[model samples]
Target: MCGIVGAVARRDIVPVLVEGLKRLEYRGYDSAGVAVLNGDIKRVRRVGRVAEMEAGVRAENLQGEIGIGHTRWATHGGVTEPNAHPHVSQGLIAVVHNGIIENHEEKRQYLRQLGYQFDSQTDTEVIAHLVHHYYLQNGDLFLAVQQVASELTGAYAIAVMAKDQPGVLACARMGCPLVVGLGEGEQFIASDISAILSVTRRFQFLEDGDVAEVRHDKIHIVDRNRQPVERKLHVSDLSLTSLELGSYSHFMQKEIHEQPKALADTIEPILEEGFSPALFGAAAAEVLPKVEGVLILACGTSYYAGMVARHWIESIAKLPCQIEIASEYRYSETFAKPNWLVVTISQSGETLDTMEALKFAFSLGHDKSLSICNVRESALPRASNLVFYTRAGAEIGVASTKAFTTQLVALFALAATLAKLKGQLSVDQEKQHLDALRLIPGSVQHALNLEPQIKLWAERFYSKHHALFLGRVLHYPIALEGALKLKEISYIHAEAYPAGELKHGPLALVDQDMPIVVIAPNDALLEKLKSNMQEVRARGGELFVFTDLDSHFTESEGVNVIRTPRHAGVLSPIVHAIPVQLLAYHTALQRGTDVDKPRNLAKSVTVE
Candidate 1:
């Protein structure tokens, strides 16, 4: 994933562009660059953080009224200055692109036949050359980008500025997200709204195939077929304060602490008004009774959330459930039951794999679709038949925390709603579930109270190279999530397995050096989980158990017990998630890794 920010404005936009790239730093990038049109394209690039690029800009006194900036997560190229974005061609055209061009090799060979020289080993460099080739023939930046876009294949969002066409910026999107910001006597474009939130909030989200020519005062838009169209303008409600680090050392730590508020914001309204199928969407009332089963599709952390939802939906709603990785689901054949609800979960809702998978399911005749997302204006919600917005606000960390907890809260609410609709849950049962949901914030807060102890555990974990996590039944997905968190931030190799599967294969990897984390809730499977822990202890494996207070687990030789709050039955997953998140955060802190933006990871996966 990469970040793009462009502006056609009256003021010198170098500072703005650099600041925009700085805001997008959390998206994970190996290099930063900016190109400005001042009679000719003046470009500066660096193979490190945005600060390095900003310093280079300052040293060179680079200033221009119109410019484009990029923070690149390397793909199809090495982390070098030549491979950084805002790639220019012949000192005439400059382009910054996000996403990949699948047919770049063919395009490159064709362009080489035309005597166009290549510079960097990036798919984006071809776009700049292609745009230059078209601009030389047409002498119109907008039409040139349009013509070049028609020749390209695969997903991309690109912003182009030509030296011959000053004060104008051309941008296009196909299968990747781009937003146009409306400002006074200025215009802005970015892959994410947060990149330019300090400048403006009013934006127009470009559809799958959209081309726009942006000027200081006006913006012209056209569809894939070249017909002019209008997109609705939305005013984002995200405040600048929410994006700040406040007192927290890192965004991951801040987000881990924000889980309680995030959960309350997601489910409190539903709890007060009581559950209704209409809470999901206006059509849910008609669609819920017709739903025979559920197919959940997601990726990364969201996929694990779906895994947990499968258990809830099957046990509570009395519905058959299936979970699939969105990336794999799109490429494989699936038998779509017409009555089965296609549920997609994502934090940003712009995950390309999940979005494409949702379309694939729809093409297979699965009509009903629901999206659980945080961003209200994202593409997934617009494409879904029903929507549930998780109010976790902006999760800037590459490794998700509050977003994951809020999703579990939303999914649990959905399960209860489905159960009530199917007559599987009685009135008293629904009330009890609602009460338990209300107490989730408090339970999460109780879990947060164990952070100091978890931080101590982190001290032991930071130096460990390998970790194994074990859980059973409802908590198995939490174990997977915990392992993912540790692997993501702390850069430690971690693997999770069902406790029952430890003997089958994973137990061989266990030793005194292997730190084994076990999630022991006070459920019926607690005894079985204890037996699994004993198996680990017998193998000279160190045990780190996150258990409920009543689980009757205590610390001894090579054993460490961190007690969570009393189990809140159905909502235990949300509570248990907090300690693992803190553990990852503090461990990454001890290891001195970038906890917010881990290496080779992006906050949102907008490309395949």
Candidate 2:
């Protein structure tokens, strides 16, 4: 994942590009670089955070109205100044890339044979050469990118600038997100909203095959086939306040408290007046009547949301749903029936892997494909047959909080909606879950209130490097999310294993130095969790648990238990997740990570 920002502005673009890059720093921080077309072509790159890299650059000499910049996480290359983005080739052109180039070796060899020398190990280097090669052949920057992009395979979102034309920037996307923002006498382009949010709110979401040519005073669009297309102007709703830390020490803490509002915002539209799933009556009739099984695809925290939804989907909808990581689903070459429903979940809606996986499923003729995403204008939602919008409202933290819970809410709601269409759910069953959902905001509020206690616990264990989380069934996903939160922010080597998998191998890693956080709510698996606790205790593991008040966690000498509300089995995980998430957030804060913008992470994984 990386953050990319670029501009073709009428005014001095260096300051605008710099400001935009600063806002996007949360997305990726391993290294940062910028390329601008001044009087003489200028490019600066370094293997460090933005602040470190920027401090050493010649701010006065870096003059340009057209430029591109990137903060990288090093998916395809080692972290070095050469590996840093804004890769330059043939003297004038520079390109910054986000996603993986699955077929880079062949392209690299092809370029080498054609007498192009590369300085970096990045799959991105091929692009600079390709663009340079195309320009040399065609003498047109726009046609160069379009031609080079056509020959390119695998996912990429690239922004290129040429010294031959200092007032324009050319960008393209294939299986990645690129947006064109329209400002007065200026046009902006970036991987997502944050980069251009500082510049303009007016944007057009670039489609998969579209190539955008952003100039200082105009923006042009073209189809993959080179047909001219009209620019669709859209006003983004992102406000300045959404970009601020807003008195909170960390974005996770801010988002944790925003859950009540986020959950309420998501459900309010459905709860308004006499709302019904019949709003999707047409889709319900067409899809649920034929859907045989479900293929749920997602990545990271959204993947965890999908995992939790499988239980509800199987229990309530009675569908055999298989949750697959998006990166795996696309290339697995499975024998899915034509009537199999495919659902992709993403918080940003621009998750590169998930979008590609959904597109692959669609290409394979899946009868129905749907998306649940926070961003309404995102590519995944637009391409899917049905879209469920999650109004989580701008999650800025690199590690998700409200976005994860809201995705769970959206997926569970979508499952119920499907079940209602299939006539599998009784009226009472539907009403009960609906009632429980309505009360969830209050439950979430209560969970957020327990942050003080979680902070105290975090202070005690923040210094540890190795931590593990364990849970069974539904809470298994929660355990994974907890581990992700810790690892993403604290840089802690943490893993989440299924509670039953203790003896399989991970048991060997447990010791006094390892802090094991167990999600043991008062469910049917309480006995199983109790047995697992003994297993950890047997191995001299130090346990820090978020268990229900009614849990059978006795006064054990070597373990510590933090009590939570003894809620229902179905609602328990959602309630129980808050404290552990809080624990991770505070632990990272105490450990002095840039909690909102951790090292080598970004708010949106637009590249891959």
Candidate 3:
């Protein structure tokens, strides 16, 4: 995920802009840059973290009253300083962009034909040039942005600064994320609240096709027709204070422990409303009758949440689901028919893969699509027929511990809503599911207590170079996610295969030096997991199993099983996700790796 932020303030806003960029560094750190306007244009950009950009600013004293900044996860170009964000056009129109511009090639070629030249190999460069092109035709900057947005077809959240329009920043979102924060004599625009939390509490969640002309004193909202629209303000309950990890060594570890509270922040709000989604009337009715099949389109942890959801949705709603990674859904020949209900899950909401998948599903004729995402104005939400916001606050860590769990909670709620709408779930069935959901946070808290021992096991495996994660059924997805977490952050070679498929190939890789992490929750698959652990032992592979206290899983010579609290088959996904995160965290810590900013990785995969 690339982070994009813009600020319009009465006084100098460069410092505040840089600070906002720092908070968003977790989203991406490959490159950073800012475009600012005082009486004139000033740009500071570098191909690294916020620290590098900050140092350049301090060493050079780049000042401006209005500005936009970006931390880039490079898409089309190499991670060079010049390729960093805030790409400036030939006519001096400046822009900071977060999603890929798929039509960049055709646009770039057309612009080149009109005697326009480019500086970097970025798809974003076309925006700066396009805005400059629009400025020549339309006298107004906001109108120019609207024109540019109309021409673009792919995902994007763009902030533009024009030299002619002093003290004002123009921003628009189609399939990317953007939020405008209301502050005293100042206004902030960011990809997420985390960037502006230290600056402002009041924010306007920008909807898709909505454009804003943000100035120090006021913000003007305009519809696609360039007609003035009323702004909607949503008060953020998240205190920026809680975003800090305090004494914890890493954000990932802090988030691992914060799951119980995070779940509360997300789940409790639904419970108070009676019906799921606070649905009472037409919204409920509209959502209920339109589904033929459920399609979950996501990437990474969200995909795992979808897998867990396939179990619940199938069990409760009797709906078959096909979960597709967002990246592949577009190019594949497969399709969703009309009336196919698509649910896309993403934390940033601007996740490129998820956004692309939604567009693809819609393009394939699926008219009804919904997004369950954390960021309000994110692209996935804007493109959907319905949007459910996850109140998980800001998950800063790239490894993704809590965000994954909150998504599961939301998916479970969606499934439950479908069950109610279908009239398949009786009141007791509804209560039972709700009760199971209610216990998740508490169970999650208890699961966090096992870290002391998990850390010990981490010590044993930190030196090992390879690992295997195995499980079946719902736990199989947990196993996949667990291995992915370890490999993503720890850089260890970890493979997750269905336990049933382990012997087909992966069993050959087992050895005394190999650490095997098995999702061994006490379910129907317990005996299968037990047998799998024994197989690992027979191969002299080290073992780690997530089990219940009553399950007789003693620490054998080659096996080490950590007992988790016994929970429902549906609820085990919540409990089982914790240890995997802890194990990865501890392993990364032991290796002295940068847990937050791992190499060759950005928090969000904004590009394909």
Candidate 4:
């Protein structure tokens, strides 16, 4: 994923564009650039972070009332300055874009035949050339952009500014996100809300095929057919504090600690008096009871959240649940039955694989779609028939912490709501689950208090080249998440398996140097998990156990135990996610790796 920010203001917009790029830097950071339309089209780009690009712009003294800026994630070419955004066309048009242009090679060849020369190996470069070609034909920037949108094949959110058109900009969106920010005497456009939040809170989200004409004092929006369209402008609810780390060392650590408030916010509606399935939606009471099964599509940490929900839905609601990696689900021949509910989970809610997977499921006769997401206005939530918004706020870290836990809270609530709708949960059982849900925030605080002792475990992990994570039943996904966190940030080679499967294959990798982390929650499988721990000990593998206070386990030679304040029954996964996140954060700190932005990985995977 890349970030795009543009503004048409009465004053010099270079500083505003640079500041907006800084807020959007978490989207991508490999390269950044900007285009300013003053007397002539001035372009400045660099092969590093946005800060480098800002420095270059200041050194060059580029000034304009209208400008567009971008921070790239390097999809089509190497992270070179020439491959950065704001690609210029014939000294007239400048373009900044997000998302892929699938047929760019064909278009590039055609443009080359028309005697257009190319400079960079980016799919986005063709956009500027194509728009310039159309502008030469019609002499209208808005019409030129509309014509070019018809020829582009893949996902794109593009902003085009012309040197001749001094105070004007045109933007179009197909599959990626673009929004128009309304101000008193200025107009702004960005790929994310955080970029333009300071400039304007009132914004209109452009739809799939909408084109927007933006100038210094006004913005006009229209659909593909050239008919004017009206869109509602909503005020944004995000504050700048959500984007800043108050006193934490890294964003991952801050997000891990933010889970309590996030969880409480997510479950607040369900905890209120007269809770019902209608709380989710008006049609939820009707649709949920008739649903036959559930098909969940997600990627990365979101997929693991689905895995945890599978246990809850099957045990509580008695529903057959299946989880699919969103990337693979579209290509697979898996058919969905009619009336089968489709659930999608994402932190950004704009993940392309998950969005495509949702479309594929709908194409196969599945009508019901629900999105569990943190973003209220992202594509995934908008495409779904029902939406459950998670108030996790903005997670800036590449490694997910608060978003994943809040997703679990949402999914668990969905399971409980479905159970109540299906008549599977009695009133007392419902009350018990609600009571446990209410305790999660305080229980998470208790788990976070184990940070000092967990630091000792982090010391053990510093030298571990390889690690094995083991869990049983409801906790296996937590084990997988733990391993994922360690590898994502610490660069450690980690693998997770069900505890019973250790003797089958993973046990052979056990040795004195390897630390075997076990998610030994005091549940029905606690004794069985303990026996598996003994197997690791017999093979000379060091044991790190995360358990509750009343557990019978004790620390011994080669084994270390960390206990929380209480044992969580049905809500154990939400509670257990904390220590593993902390473990990963501290381990990454010990390894001297970047905890916020891991190398070669972007926070949002917008491209395939």
Candidate 5:
């Protein structure tokens, strides 16, 4: 969860580098630095926000038309000036890196034996020293970087500049994101499209193990074997205005309010015609008929999205479905059947753990995998045999809001398609589900209307030290997502359990000081969930419930209720998540915490 920006332009690039880093700030970073070659390499690193780095650049009058910059989330070393990037090697080469070098210690010792000293306790500095080690022997910047990349182990996206290689930047990526921007008499490189969008949208996404050389007027890309590679330049249609905070106080608030539209976009394609298995891809029509079971792989919020889909798949499609946390799946000797349909869900499509799990699953004979992701051309989407683009747009907030709901929309569509293929749904039933899907946007708007009530309920959370969220069956994942949001932004210790599981252990932690959040959709399990809520109240636990309009529950002493529009039937999870998101947003706002870029977190987990 770091950012890298490099550019070679005919004019002063300091301002461009600063603004680029500003855009990448959403990715989350604790320090920022830049290096430029003006006859010699000059660099400035600060152990704070990009604004501080900008001030440092201006005060020091750091100017160069060619430079590389980084915004780092500390990994190998502590967050300090010396640990910041653009770390110079022998005062001749500067390198900025993202991701971890798993074998840096061995290389560090090897370099020390060769009379090379390290200034910062960083794996990145090893890359710099290793580059210098190779450059001294080969006298070629590109070959030196290639040699260093060959020697290093683990994930990294690095941009390098040498005094001898003025007006040029060499970059390489493995298990991290890197893109090259095309412009007139200039070229750019960045970790993501947002960083270089203001400069140029025409860009090429660098695949893992690809090395790039960006010059003022041209750019070259090569594979790990040093063979020339051709990658198409894509002109992104994302509006710069979409990245801005409009009337909303924070990006998290803005994103929370954008769920209606995001869900609408996700369902639009399936709604155009009735939902069908063929909507997934051309092979889905054939694959759906033979599919014996379902397997879902994902991490973080996307993993919770997969959990909600497990209920949808088993109950609706009547398929035996299993879910795995991506990080653990890779290390497990899990069984993967060839007939099972494996699905991977991610917002960025570059989640390292999920990507690795997908690869590992494929290696185990589960090659028929699909990716439900937001970003096009990202690693997960590109690697999948079939892809369902979520169309959630760019989710800038570190705490996901719109992305989670939109992923559920996609998953529900997949469920309906599978159910139809399995003869579990008739034509009439399919039409009804489509109509319900069509009404989701309106239902989400109604959920947003309850924010004022949710905000009022959130006032009690300003002093809360702990929270417990309760839901039953399908809604349990929503409960988990709500608890995660509370802990993420509000910094309150929170936990979620299936309402039935409370008495087993978590109920002991409940007291008047603990707030219990109940996602009480008016399903068959409502009565059971209500009984569980009563147990919390019996222990003097405060209750905040988000329920349907016709639910039997009501507001009273020690109980708060925010009524939603109506029960969404099978699509209730998508509707119920809105209030949960708003609850977290307003609680964070009330607590005066960073609502968008929560501390110690990044928007995209590009590294393990």
Candidate 6:
């Protein structure tokens, strides 16, 4: 995913644009650039982080009151300075864009036929040239952007500025996200609210196919059909302190510690009133009762959260559940049923795969839909009929921590609510579940206390080239998440298998140097997991077990044990997620890798 930020203000906007890009650094980018307009367009582009671009801007002393900035995540070309955004056409117009333009080749051919030479190997360059073509004919920046937007196909959010019109900035959204920030005597547009939070909190979220014309004093919006439209302006409650990494070495470590508050914020509201279908939404009373089964669509850590929910839904609610990786679900033929509830999960609700999958489910006559998301204003939650906000705040780390655990809390609450709706849970049973949910925040705090021990485990893990993670039944998804975190940040080769499946094929890879991590919860599968651990030990693999406080597992030769907080029944998955996160964070620290932004991995997967 890329980040875009633009501002129309009275003061010099170069500092504001650069600071906005710095705030959006967590979204991940390979190259960055900024274009400003005074009497003419002055721009700077760098083939690295935003800091590099800032250095270039400083060296050149670029200044303007109107400008657009971008941090590009290289979708169409190599991570080169020329491929970075703020693409200029005929030295008159500069454009910064996010999302793929599916028909760029056709537009590029037409523009080349018009004798417009290309400068970079990016689809976004087509946008600049195309707008220039339209601007030449229409002599209006807004009309030019409107015409170009109508011609472009595929998901895109773009902001364009012309040197001829220094005070006007035109932006549009097709399928990707864009927001307009309302400030006193100034206006701003950014792909994310966090990017402009330092300047303004009041925002208008642009809908699909909406185009906006921004000026220093006013903003005008229009729909796809060129009809004037008004969007509701929302004042956000997010604080600047939440985005700061105070006293924490990295964002991953800070978010790992924030899980206790994040989980409490997610589930405490529902626990206060006990379990109720209305906790999801007002329509949950009618919509959830008709559900025959569940189809969960998600990607990455959110998909793993769905996997954990599948266990809870099937065992506790006695319902059939299916989990689909959102990226793959759209291409497969599905037997869609109307009564089945389609659940989509994402931390940033702008995940394109999951968003497209939700649309696919809607087209299949699956109207009973729900979205579990962290961002309230994101597209997925706005599109779904019922929404559950995870309230995880801003998850800045590329590898998820608080967002993942908060999703588990939301999914567990969904499982319990569905169980109550299905008449499978009695009053006392619901009370028991609610009581356990209430204790989760404290349990998460106890798990946070284990970071010292996990840091010790990281010492042993940083040197290992490969690792194997093991879990059984309810904990298998957690094992998968653990391996993902370790590999994502530490750059260690890690894999996970159900403990029973180790003998099938994964056991063959076990050897003395391989570190085998086990999620040995004291559940019904503990004995079977112990047998699987014995299989690894027989082959001289050292075991690193994250087990329960009362699991009775002791440290011995060739094996080490780290006891987590006492298991909290259905909420064990949320608690167990903490140590693994710590293990990954500290291991990345040991390996001297960038823990917050891993190599080549963006925080949000906005592109395919």
Candidates' RMSD to native: 1.0, 2.6, 2.9, 1.3, 1.1, 0.9
Per-prediction count of colliding residue pairs? 0, 3, 3, 0, 0, 0
Residue-level lDDT tens digits of model 6 in 1-608: 89999999899999999999998877766989999998988999998889999999999999999999999888898999889989999989999999999999999999999999998999999999999999999899999999999999999999999999988999999778899999998999999999999999999999999999999888999999989999998999998999999999888888888887888898878877666778788898899988889999999999999999998899888899999999999988986885999999999999999999999998888999899999878899899989899988898999998999889888888888888888999999988988888888899899889888888889989999999999987899999999999999999999989999998999999999999999998888888899999999999999999999988898999889999888777789988988888888999999999998898988988888
lDDT of 1 by residue, 1-608 (tens): 88999998999998889989988877657999999988778989999899999899999999999999999998888999889988889989999999999999999999999999988999999999999999999899999999999999988999999997888999999887899999999999998899899999999999878999999999999999999999999999899889899998888888888888898898877876677887788998898888999999999999999999999999999999999999999999767886999999999998999999999999899999999999977889989999999999899999999999899988988898889889999999998999898899999999999988998999999999999999888889999999999999999999999999999999999999999999999998998888989999999999999999877877899888988989879788888988888888899999999888898988879889
For all candidates in order, the CA lDDT equals 0.91, 0.81, 0.83, 0.90, 0.89, 0.91
Q: How many residue pairs of model 2 clash at the backbone?
A: 3
Model 1 scores worst on lDDT over the 10 consecutive residues at: 268-277
In model 5, pairs of residues that clash are none
Any residue pairs clashing in model 3, and if so which?
A: 1-604, 1-605, 547-564
Off by over 4 Å in 3: 110-116, 133-140, 143-147, 269-282, 289-292, 335-340, 363-368, 382-388, 416-432
What lDDT score is found at residue 88 in candidate 2?
Answer: 90
RMSD, model 1, all Cα superposed? 1.0
Model 4 regions more than 4 Å off: 273-275
Q: What does candidate 1 score on TM?
A: 0.99
Over 4 Å off, model 1 = none
RMSD of 6: 0.9
Query: Which wins on TM-score, candidate 1 or candidate 3?
Result: 1
Better of 4 and 5 by lDDT: 4
- Candidate 5, residues 376-461, lDDT tens digits: the string is 89999888877888878888889988999999988998888888888998999999999999999999999998888888888878
lDDT of 2 by residue, 1-608 (tens): 77788887656677777677777777788889888877756878877778766765655457777788888887877888889988999786889987888788999999999999999999999999989988888878899999988888887888988878777789988877788888888888887777778768888888877888888777788988888888567887777787677898767788888888888888776565222454333465566667777899999889899999999889878888999999888998776676777989898888878887887887787758888888867888777877778888888778888888888877777677767767887888777777777888887787788888888888877889899999999899899989988888888889999999999999999998899999988888888888898999998998888887777776577778778765645766677678878888889888998787777667777665
Give the TM-score comparing model 2 with the true structure, all chains together: 0.92
Candidate 1: clashing pairs of residues: none
Worst 10 residues of 5 by lDDT: 273-282
Pairs with steric clashes in candidate 2: 27-601, 27-602, 99-607
Model 3, range 1-608, lDDT digits (tens) per residue? 68988888777788888988888888788989988886567888997789999999988888888889999887789999778988888646899998888899999999999999888999899999999998889867888898998888777889998988887789997766688999998899998888888878898887768899888888998877778887678787777766787998778887888889889888886677644545322354676577867888888888999999999888888877788887888789986666768989888887777777777777777888788888766667767778777777777888888889988888888787887777778899878777887888888888888989999988987898989999888888899998998988889988899898877889999988888888887777788777777777888888887887667778867678788877555878888998898889999889888898887777766666
